[model samples]
Target chain A: MKKKKMIISSQTMELDVVRKVEALSGTSVRRCFQCGKCSAGCPMATFMEHPPNRIVRLLQLGQWQRILAGRSIWYCASCETCSTRCPNKVHLASIMDALRKLSWDAEGPSKESYVQLANRLFLENIRSYGRQYEMRLAAVFNVKSGQFLKDLMLGPKLISKGKLKMFHQKNRNMAEIEKIFSRIEEMRKKGEAL
Target chain B: MDKTLNYAYYPGCSLHASAGEYDLSTRELFNLLGVGLTEVPDWFCCGATPAHNVDELLSLSLCAKNLELAEQVDGDVAVACAACFSRLKFTQHTLLEDETKRRQVEKAIDAPARLDGKVKHLLEILARDIGLERLASAVSKPLSGVKVACYYGCLLTRPPDVPNLDCVEAPTIMERVVEAAGAETVPWSHRMECCGANFTLSRPGVVIQLSNAILDSAKSSGADCVVVACPLCHGNLDMRQKEIEGVYNAEYGLPVFYITQLLAVACGAGAEKSGLGALMVDPFPLLKVKNIL
Candidate 1:
């Protein structure tokens, strides 16, 4: 394996990009000392292309494009292990969250589209019914993501036990929820509806 | 009458669907305990794990709505799912601490940012408010000699400062509650571990591997069954137990129970009301052998 080093270079380091990540996450990136505690405790780090600490290091080096396009952000389940384990309180989970949003905005299409699809379906269920429609969330996510039959066998088994309700339980506060989504649109500073 | 205890119940998405067992057992157990639980009318989703992965404002807005709804009622809000409990309590902590973030969330939800109501997990209710002594006395069936591994999973007590529900590193709230039900909680390192939550769907392979680790620990620790406070953890550990066994080429006959389900049975609600039938990995065989079923 070839050796790689993190040498500080003014030409490669973009402080503004790091500042943007700090601002978006509302967490102090400056507090991280490369201690790797966040990466150590992360359960998803093994599956990630870049560990949480690596992403944080990239952010420190202003590699916004690299981090945004990476699968590390999409894989983070936001278990908060990294956030809680960090001695500096870096809140790596929040930074990973910011990166996920940025990935959707900048990267166009993600290989983790099934996950992205599910997130949208989750929100859409809430937007329409005032609460998450779990059955429909799966149906929509499967169909839209082209991952049909994902839980094909398990679905019937769960339904048989009455675990997955077929009928939707629409909350009476549907209009109120709609108003909130709309108001959020007006309040958004990111200028992106999604 | 004025002294009657009450709690506003917020059964999140899973409780209504996948984790109906958790909901059923919670209500059934609480009913047996004589604690009044009223549903938080028209409560919405807390966005769970996925929402935060997408957008911050979206995540905060969804949780804030439920918090606002809870404000309409009187006493503290009670929840069965750990994810919901964490989201509700975490949002409250974040909003109360950061004025700018609070304002943004309020603007996003179009609701005032005041979590006047206390959001608590069911374990907290059993451990703190009801007290272990009261819980122990209420147990009529006494899950006698049942070895339980009370899995807190990820959310129930992480991000130490935010929830502050118990000792973050070594939370025993679940264990304390299980002990009250006459079950011996096995000491294990995987109690506070992550079970790949929503990734159970997005990344099934990852879920299987991670869940196997938890199951391995529970088995090695001599636990007869695994218990959880989160529906996602239950789904991964219980629903995907077979897949985990197949992947790792091992058998984990351990039945995963919601903490509430264990309490429901111990309090004499019977297995019928405990939702034991809904479990993907059957706990009945073990329960029958132990005379708990």
Candidate 2:
């Protein structure tokens, strides 16, 4: 197995991430005691760079830079195990979500491969048509990720197996989908306006 | 006639496709049971796993559209697909539980869809609305001693609020439903384990391992067969059974059935009427052993 080398930078604070964290957390972030219970309970944290408890502490300590760059935010399964079990009821998932938005805004360390591809295909499909079409998303993701040549043989086999559908059912009102996206885009700009 | 509740039923992509049996059987059963499911007037995708993995707001907001439509009808929505039910349920759960974040999601989606009323899966409604006694009385054919392993995959039970129908670690709705159908529910591990859902495509090896664990666990528990409420779970366990067997160099020929299929049997509906044979793995032989046929 090959190990990939990377660099670590000194952490700093950014007000936007802090404000975002405070905005999402109903109770004060100060209530947390760094028990590591939340991270211990997270089912998906095994795949995370930093688990829920650490992310919360980062906010408590005002290490906003590291919080924004950690890839753990993207990998959370949103399972709510941590939130439901939290003693302080700090809503760790909600905090992670806000940090995720900050991470996307910062465009930090390379997004995990499958997570990035899946996100693009999913949003593009939703933006284009009102609903998801799995086959279409798989094709788009495969092509964009440059895996077309490797799985070239499996494509035809999948089609023959009836695993991949030939076409997708578009929503009856596509204009409505576009309008919804526009409204969301407008709101995103407004949120960023401040 | 109380027509108070209205919803946009986002049957996940598989509901109408390979899992059409689930799509059809659920529609029939729900109507018979008096739950009004007006297919969303205009619906979009739930973004499955990708949306949430890619962008939390994107997935939650996309799900909010379906919930928003339910709000337009001024009623709560119900989803049949396990993955769809879990995703939409999580969105509603997230919003209602956190006021500030909920506001952000509402803002992110640019729609103020009220997340009222429980987003129920078919099994929960049956177990709750159509009580076990009523279900038992309606059973024209008692499942008797048929051993069924009730498999609740990660989505339906985990993330607490998503299903919140029963214990996440040990869900009993499928067990209760199977009991109502006159079948014995077999207790086993891997009941809450992930079946690698959509990962069956991207990572078949992982899926094979997960599927094998489930099948082997059920077999060890003395289950003659397995029953599931989620079509995606059924597809993974049933369609991939052979692959799992091949990969493990073991024969685990357990038959998997949709809970509704077994209910149709208990209701005295013939297999033809219920489209039981349409499953990727035929369950007739198991039915024969139980004398259900």
Candidate 3:
């Protein structure tokens, strides 16, 4: 890869943004040389508005809004294909994760999409049951996302096969699970990244 | 090798719900093999896919709590679900590699993270712990002439270092296991392909597209059926095969079997005990044809 000739300027590099992404992901955006390996191996790249390579390029240029405005961040499935295939060892999956965390917080009420909605419902389910209660998660998600009847047809079949349980099962250490969440929330309130 | 080996089995949420068959088959297969698997007492979820993507600390902490529980058991944690395997291994990797994150997870779980070899997928136990030779000798009803496509899916071998079991891009552990049971595994390109597991619930179309491609690859390779270790992959490829055909406007009548189910069948256990009755894709006709039912 050849470096592009450009004059260096303080305004050209968003040092704080770069450092923040690095701190959270522990992967340097500067390590990416636009090799496109990450995007090349990404299965969901076609569905994404901006491919992972372009997102990394945007990150390198410190164009936070340009990267976040697109739905690409939400499209990542985090399969780790890119992370495994990267010769630069960039861990694009983790970077995508960091970006999603940032973008999710920045999302407005009207900005909710299916992936975002599912993610919120998923965490909420985990927070409550300590494990994914599939039927409950789906029903609550359907109610919240206003897709009440979505996947309704599949429920009875799943139930008949004993795949979906009617009653919720809680972990033995529900108090411990609750404490873990509270500890993380308490840390977040104190300005922690995670 | 010891006649009997023990493991702290950590069947994740799916085992109690959607993947009950997998849990049943795993226990049955292990029982016939003289392998003792003790379920970790009161084990919580391993934080699977969503937790890591949402909060790194919460993900690590969730996995750490399970690891702490497994530490009280006899052996390294043995998991059947690929997602739980990946998350738990990744948690151990993270807690070992980064001290600050380790401290954070330590604080969250109220337990010290033991990164010293406490997590392993069931495949590792079969292929490495219990030698393939032993498994082969134990097989009474060999699935001879049965052409199978061993699907590794994504999480079991990807990211190279997490589970760190087989070749990342092209895994062969599943093939070796099934092959030892006298089944012939066809060489296929989509072994480690992503089954769009995360999109199974939210976006059915994507799952259909990706899973169809995998099914197509397996079919073109002349596979009689498909074998999988991941519950979500099995769910997408088997439970939704009809919908997948509808979406792609093509037919792929592949019977997806959990590796343990097939292993149990090979080990002389009845199909019912292997949970074959619970499968969406009917394997009875095919198994009867092969005289392995």
lDDT of each: 0.82, 0.70, 0.84
The reply for model 1, stretches above 4 Å from the true place, is: A1-12, A107-109, A189-194
When just chain B is superposed on the true chain B, each candidate scores a TM-score of: 0.97, 0.91, 0.97
- Please tell me how candidate 2 rates in CAPRI terms: acceptable
True contacts kept of each: 0.68, 0.28, 0.63
Best by lDDT: 3
What DockQ would candidate 3 receive versus the native complex?
0.67
- Evaluate model 2: give its TM-score: 0.81
DockQ of each: 0.62, 0.30, 0.67
**What value does the lDDT take at residue B103 in candidate 1?**
81
Better of 1 and 2 by DockQ: 1
Candidate 2 displacement at residue A172 in angstroms = 0.7
The full ranking of all candidates by DockQ, starting with the best, is 3, 1, 2
Q: Per model, how many backbone clashes are there?
A: 0, 3, 0
Per-residue C-alpha lDDT of model 3 across residues A114-183, encoded as one tens digit per residue:
7777777778777788778888877877887788788788889888888889887788678888999999
Range of the 10 consecutive residues with the lowest summed lDDT in candidate 1 chain B = B1-10
What's the DockQ of model 2? Answer: 0.30
TM-score for each candidate, following the candidate numbering: 0.95, 0.81, 0.96
C-alpha positional error of residue B242 in candidate 2 after TM-score superposition, expressed in Å: 3.1
Residue A73 displacement (Å), model 2: 4.6
Better of 2 and 3 by lDDT: 3
Q: Rank by TM-score, descending?
A: 3, 1, 2
